[model samples]
Target: MSNRSHEVEYEQMLLSRHGLWQHKGGRGKDGPMERSAYILLSRIRVQGPMSIGELSDAFGLDASTLNRQTAAAMRSGLVERIPDPAGGMARKFQITDMGARMLDEKRDYFVQALDKVMADWSDDDIAHFASYLRRFNSDIERIEGRPWPRPGTDGP
Candidate 1:
């Protein structure tokens, strides 16, 4: 079968540019959290607390980058550093109550926006689209060997 690599690449770029992650509908004075902050907090929420080393491995990011991100998060009171629950040497970053609240608000806003956008789509079509996107993301995660933790599943 022929590959539609170019088509997929262009469409993916467009989607990224127009995606919910970039939406500007935050409900508070501070506006939405930065993309990095959102993703980091989301990961922590899904997978529990994470140390710097674990975050680095999970995201394939460097220590310096994670340090900056986590530091910013701490300053904003979105996360806190605590002794590892497992009694490990490195401290873990845990999302704060405020962080969870903000994340939930942002997520709810995004869902509302998506609902409006997909108002005309059938339930079956939405399910199919979600399935395809999950498959695509799973394939990417498999290739990278860095599976993400899903809410209802063991992993990925």
Candidate 2:
């Protein structure tokens, strides 16, 4: 591996060891959504309804995997399948009202947790860190050809 690759690998390993991404279930109205559900709902929330094919293209995942994830989300009342508004043959998934509320709650919880973790960091430092993260993610997305949508812009 190159020098930068080695450094990135070490940092990523340390981040994993920190256990910050571990699921903290059992909270909110539905006991907190799963990570997959949270991400899938977030995409739908931002981009409106999306068919399975669209999701597969966006996430670079196969239909079977998306099927399972969407099924679980539907069972959890987080998303529902509706006919494509554009008259397409395949149905699209849309976030439900409950899903929206739960997404908001879950997002708030995550923001609060991050704020607590960064309590000692200065505002400028945090901003710089955020900028770096966005750049990093955007570069990866560019390489993968699967850019994500973001608020206040056409896409992330």
Candidate 3:
């Protein structure tokens, strides 16, 4: 087996073993907010005040699907939709202060949950894994599209 093929297979196996597919239920087969909502919030955090159409395009989802999730978020006061300041077509959605606060709280919960869940792991090991996992995510985004999660960093 070639080195590149082996590496690809290893990564695939690792992802399959631990990705959303391996959870008790299939992705979005179980979540209340729907995975679409999560992606919307994440993109909103990164991109800021994007129109629904743009979000739909970025995630390869349809406007209806995106609108459904955005509607739910709006009802919950997690997002706010406003007229596009520049005026053109689609209205823009922005995360509210409440939404940002919720994201931060969720992060803290994740940290605590992982710490308790991995109580036996050494601090150094955990830190290393966290850093590498973050880098891996960043690299995958670059591979899939371009330098994102840090816009415009991809060199010439």
Best by TM-score: 1
| Candidate 1: regions farther than 4 A off | 1-3, 19-23, 30-32
TM for every model, in the order presented, reads 0.92, 0.91, 0.63
Ranking according to lDDT, highest score first: 1, 2, 3
In candidate 2, stretches whose alpha carbon ends up further than 4 angstroms from where it belongs are: 21-26
TM-score of 1: 0.92
Q: What is the per-residue lDDT of model 2 for residues 45-135, given as tens digits with 9 covering 90 to 100?
A: 8898999999999889999999999999999899999999999899999999999999998888778878999999999999999998888
lDDT by residue (1-118, candidate 1, tens digit) is: 3369888988899977876665565444555588788899999999998999999999989999999999999998889999999999999999999999888888787889889989
Query: In candidate 3, which residue ranges exceed 4 Å CA deviation?
Result: 1-35, 86-88, 146-156
Query: Please, what is the whole-model Cα lDDT of each candidate in the order they appear?
Result: 0.87, 0.87, 0.68
What is the lDDT, from 0 to 100, of the residue 105 in candidate 2?
83
User: Which 10 successive residues of model 2 have the least lDDT summed?
Assistant: 18-27
Q: Tell me the lDDT of model 2 at 43.
A: 90
